[model samples]
Target: MVFPRPRPPERSDPASCGTHRACRSCWRDPGALPQGHGRIRRYAAGADLAAQGEPPADILTLIEGWLLLSALLSDGRRQILHIVVPGDVVVPLLVGSAGFGIQAATDATVCAMPVAAATTSPTAHPAGLHVLMKAMSRNAAMAYEHLTAVGRRTARERVALLLVELYYRCRRAAIPDHAVQIPLTQGVLADALGLTAVHVNRTLKTLRADGLVAYEGGMLRILDPDRLAAAACFDVEAAGAWLGPCPPGPPTPVPPTAPMPPGASR
Candidate 1:
């Protein structure tokens, strides 16, 4: 079921949209876009938002919950391309072809806008173009970084880095370290990191033993913030160096309340 949800953003002057930083700034800038049409829709956990090879016909911004961009192999194996959280834009593919499909990892709500607006905004609005460029560069850098991790990183390093990535993605200035939660299972981790489920289990066990992180059921708690990345030789600083400095951004803002679609579970 889909419902109309367009609650105006109460983003008090300084706030974090908490998705992709570049896009956050784009939304805040009044001149960033011209008036556009958009509507909100909701999906249940495990629902297919976009089918494989399907080109996105609209600009979809995740309003709540989690989404996974993944590809299914001939042998029935799946590799997760990336995870989508609130304030993040969802694109099946950024270039060439979209061999992937998007699924709601949890019950999710999305705001979809006209793709034509996105295609024209950059040219009609210079600020929009700048944001688009920044987003592209960030995407490229992350793609390279992910490729490097799968090719060169150890099992522990890969798992650790993946968790750290999620931690930062969902980071909230008000949420304490222990309170930060990522609702993902080991199978999801294994798919995202290119590892066997058994290997992912052992690696997580070792991480728990080291007192760096904890995983039980489908939830994860980061026990030690300072040591989690360092424990796996995952250098967040070095990775950022390639992309240039990121000025301190405001804390991520809570998303607008979107009413659930009828028949959706709580």
Candidate 2:
């Protein structure tokens, strides 16, 4: 199912909107933009940014909110291939090849430009571009890790690994690691982990029992990150150095309560 690219950002007074370091790092080069660059747009809680099998267009960077990239099987089952957060970019082709990529989840705000323009922008510094490439590679590696999690880890271990991964990513984005925040649902987690929703539920309970994590109403708290990472066979340091010094940014803030994603209880 192909969906249209999101609308271009509206022209607005630059003076009215406050600037953040993270978004600046993404679109500007030390406080300046290349000529001909477009504006950054905002997306509501359930907007669709891209669809499967569409033409390769601009490179999209999620400045805010959570996004899921998914692929569907012939049987009509959807497999969430990736989860994107602020500062993450999605292109049809990560490095080599071409095809339409689809958005698998929701609550995403995206900024995109023609791929050619994006690559040539001076503000799109070489280092920033390199970081984006590395981000894509990391996402690929994560997919492999997910495969292993479902294929080898016990149900409990899978849940632990998922929570650990989420916490780690939230930390990198500067989101509060202990905050009660979970943007995905048990069913979505099941799809990504290749488990049934019921099994995902049971495994989550097991994680709480082991003091590894806690989940309620789609919110999760990592009780023992070390133990959880160990159970998932996750080495925090293995996350490569491609992120480029975590980009100058303010800590990610928890917004006032909003509607959780579909299938999410809390």
Candidate 3:
């Protein structure tokens, strides 16, 4: 089925959310103060919302479906940095970021406005500012989390943590029957986690065997949320915090690793 541009949600519509009541999501009560209204744009799945080197001068806020925020390396490698859903403010040229692009992971609609107008609108609503602030904070934390996962986590741990993250992110969208929708392919997972598709596949298999999580038919089921979090060392609160993750604590050996042998041959 094709997704169409959403109608402006009136006060009675569920989509018409209050500033704080919207739970940090962006689009709601279109044309209302704080959530400036704009022209609606629709994108098909796999369509580039923002091309690798060309970013639109206007801001595009999601009205529905998922988006893949990515960056392309000079060597032609792509890194899937974030997967965003409805009520998220997204633009290709994120502040201080170059080489980043956004693609539609599923059919989507967005409310678009020019940068200058969006910033200087008479209805400079706090909700709009909240959306911008929270999105930046959360996205930055996510990038840092991904960096840690890629650098220090095992393949299985990385996959588990990623799944756990998605589980929580989709909770707001509803996890019907313990399952969350995941439209991404293993290749996307591989790019996100800095692993090969084979590695992601094998790690997912291990997660299934461990009864932590399992994926099938575009859904990921968390069979054991507690156990899965333990395996991933996931800090759920930090992951979902609206004010952004807490300042990280100093590290210590948990399972404890031995230091490199003294005077070992280089």
Candidate 4:
């Protein structure tokens, strides 16, 4: 598909321009491209950014809005793997047949860099390579965490943990607020959490009644972040370690490697 000509990068804080902290850090490097290198494309909600089973071509970074990485069952059921927010890089890693696909969850913009360029551009700069490697590592860590949540967490815990995770991820993006804008419907949440929409609705209601969170008009207010975290049993230290410098602790046990899923490797 033909994309529009790229737009100029936002003039404000470079890191603040997108969602991925690693992408932002790389942008801040002295050797970073002055105008940035990539084609920025706008996608309508529900558009396919990358299709499963298609040959990989470019690495995409969300510049605005949300995307969903998902897989389709033979019976046509959709299993959402993860949500992609701004600055999240979408890389293609699986060969032969794609295991997942990327769909825009909302009207969005993404920067598309040719895989060849994305790989070779950072070779001359140690800082750029470091940032890129960290980003990839963090992405893998998060994928493992998602797998764990899907495989083991209870319905309530899964929903709560997702909220907590999003809250902190937004905070890491420098969005300073107690409220988070969740551009997902209950159905989407259900798909991501491996629960039915009714179950998700019930869980959310319970959270609201407990005064742990408030969801209204597409915004989620964390009324009691501490209580919410407690409910989800969120590991704050481990989760936030990938974001920035923190006191060292025992390393987070690496989740066993599995076949590459669409969003898991890039």
Candidate 5:
């Protein structure tokens, strides 16, 4: 199904909005913008950003919230391919018509731009294509990590690896404290980890009992990150370097400029 892009709402500077550093980095000149650039659009929880089998249109950069790239089976079962956090980009052509769908895991804000604009001359959009390339590389690295988790690791290890991944990602994003809001239910977790929801619950319970992690009130806390990393065999620093240096301290506010592109809604 083809989706229409919505008009962006007038807003203050993109930098002031505390957008992801990846998004801010895409702008070569924060003070100037190309003519007819895309606009930002917001999606409520459960919205579909892109559907499987649809022709590719725009490239989406997540500015806020979490998104899931998933595929549905013939029997109506869904397998989540990836958890897309802020600072990530969704390029439909990468997965092509392999039946992958992009959906918001939470209320999300994204910037969509024409694929041509992003792939055209780098001189035209400046850092836009460069940042997109880096984001794509990072996504590929994450995919490889997920493959190892699902194809070889035990269920407990799978869960541990996921938590470790999120912990480091949040830290790199400078999301304040060590605690993270998982924003995923047991069912979703099961799908992502290729386990049954019951199994996911059991593994989480075991982790809690071991004082390695805590999941309560919609928050997931790593009580012993060191132990959790050991269990998952995850090296936070060695995961990938495609995600450029995370800004120290709070998110540095950028000067406001024209908005980017509009994303699709479910």
Candidate 6:
């Protein structure tokens, strides 16, 4: 199967958000946000939403587009630690998992809120706190698995795992027909996989040769998803936990002042 070229990132518009309701998971409990909390924000491609070493702020939920959370080595080399896609939280774990900053890989939008406001607002809802804790625990587990990929997997294995991960993420977002619409560059893939661009290109070529992945322009299609996942040593447990319950009223953005859980990592 050949994947079509991904369209350009969606332009953000603040007036476009319909209502200020909490996310489905949060709203489900009826006790999530205080009666009058939450805010939405839009970001352009290459925008830095959260920088490393900065004080904790509101948690960010990715309403659209791709995002990268990376950290700098002592030598200044950047390592792409995690990729945040639609429905994923940018800073869900806590304030001190690692020294990583979050940025948009493409045009994106998010709902951000202050950490303190989230926990302290007199209107804090118990149901909302329950959902938030569950989300953070889930994210923590994923970070551990991704760390394993970088530390123990071969370069090819790492790339395969990453693509499989992306495929699942897109699917959970209910993106049509299992399509991956992110404009992931070779250099970005290299950073995420902890390899050089040359190595990334070579591995992609190999996947193409095996007919496991089809690439055109910058888009990629997993022709034989089973084979691809197998090659990557994909973990069903990690993938399963990565996706939360479906959202209500489609995907939407939240306010930037959302609370920051102490355990939120990236």
> What overall lDDT goes with each candidate model?
0.61, 0.59, 0.60, 0.64, 0.66, 0.64
The residue ranges of model 5 lying beyond 4 angstroms of the native Cα positions read 1-22, 25-35, 94-98, 121-123, 177-179, 215-218, 242-266
Measured by TM-score, how close is model 6 to the native structure?
Answer: 0.78
TM-score of each: 0.74, 0.74, 0.72, 0.76, 0.77, 0.78
Give the top-scoring candidate (TM-score): 6
The residue pairs found clashing in candidate 1 are 16-252, 16-253
- Among residues 3 or more apart in sequence or in different chains, the pairs in candidate 3 whose N, CA or C atoms overlap within 3 Å are 26-87, 34-125
Model 1, C-alpha of 22: deviation from truth (Å): 14
lDDT of 1 by residue, 61-161 (tens): 77778889888877688999877766566543444545777788888777655555656644346765565566556656766877888999999988878
Residues 1-266, model 2: lDDT tens digits: 43355443333223211154445656445333333454455655545555566556666667667777776655678777777767676766735433334452555556655566546655555755665566567667777888887789888777777776766565566544334355677777887777788888777666667876554454566667678778877776664443223223346533212123344332
Clashing pairs in 5: 13-256, 15-254, 38-260, 38-261, 39-260, 39-261
lDDT string for model 6 (1-266, tens) is 11122232234334322254425432454446544345667677887776676566667767767789888666667888788877776544455643677778887777665565556677666665665677677778778878899899998899888877776666566434334465677778888888988888788778878888764443465676568889998855546756543223223321111111122222
Number of the candidate with higher lDDT, 1 or 2: 1
What is the TM-score ranking, best to worst?
6, 5, 4, 1, 2, 3
Residues 137-232, candidate 3: write the lDDT tens digits: 766777788899989999888887877666555555542333245666778888889998877777776776777654433345567655776798
Top lDDT prediction, candidate number: 5
- In the range 151-228, model 4's lDDT, one tens digit per residue, is 999888898888777756654543332223657777788788889877777787788789986544344556765678
Error of 1 at 80 (Å): 0.4
